[model samples]
Target: MSGTLHLAQALSNRRRRGRKKDFRDAERLVKRLVSQELTLSFVPDGEHRLWRTLTRTRYQRTRDKVRLQNQLEALLEEAHINLSSLVSDLLGASARRRCMR
Candidate 1:
């Protein structure tokens, strides 16, 4: 027997119930979960969640590194240092060596 189940809200034809929603409505939702009434939907397993977390973190770090490099380049240009003009890479070895001077 499959012990795991994932579900989502099944779109309903019920009339719109607006700002009057309260704790009782939440209780109903819990009851649905208990009774396996929610519509089936994609739910990633533990391994997939871990993989997503790792990849997302790596992607975000890469973006942050690139952003910081761009900011540094802009700040250097604003200070009238045209290191990027002389070097193919602003943060490369040659530029950094020149900067150390």
Candidate 2:
């Protein structure tokens, strides 16, 4: 038995359409995968599941911050603001002073 877990999406066939066909396809696929020595993973333990959730949340927040920064820079550019050229971060003191004026 293979201990390594392999994750893959189910095959979508346009010709096959019912739940029975899907069940059959899934059964066949599992048999073929087992023959090839691949195993699907089960749910992780509590700690690992919590870690995954936290990491995913952090990643999403980072992405949102980056997206917001990009939008701010784009808006400033549209308004003919060049604070980015003067300061590395447009959210810093120099840019804030410029914006205040």
lDDT of 2 at 26: 70
Show model 1 residue runs off by greater than 4 Å.
10-39
Question: How far in Å is the alpha carbon of 57 misplaced in model 1?
Answer: 0.6
lDDT of 2: 0.74
In candidate 2, list every pair of residues with a backbone clash: none
The collision pairs in model 1 are none
Provide the lDDT at 89 for model 1.
Answer: 77
Best by TM-score: 1
lDDT of 1 by residue, 7-51 (tens): 664673132477646686667766777787766578898999999
Candidate 2 on 1-101: residue-level lDDT in tens?
66754564334222345565767867776776768644445668789999999999999999998899889999989999777888887767887887888
Q: Highest lDDT: which candidate?
A: 1
TM-score of each candidate? Answer: 0.65, 0.57
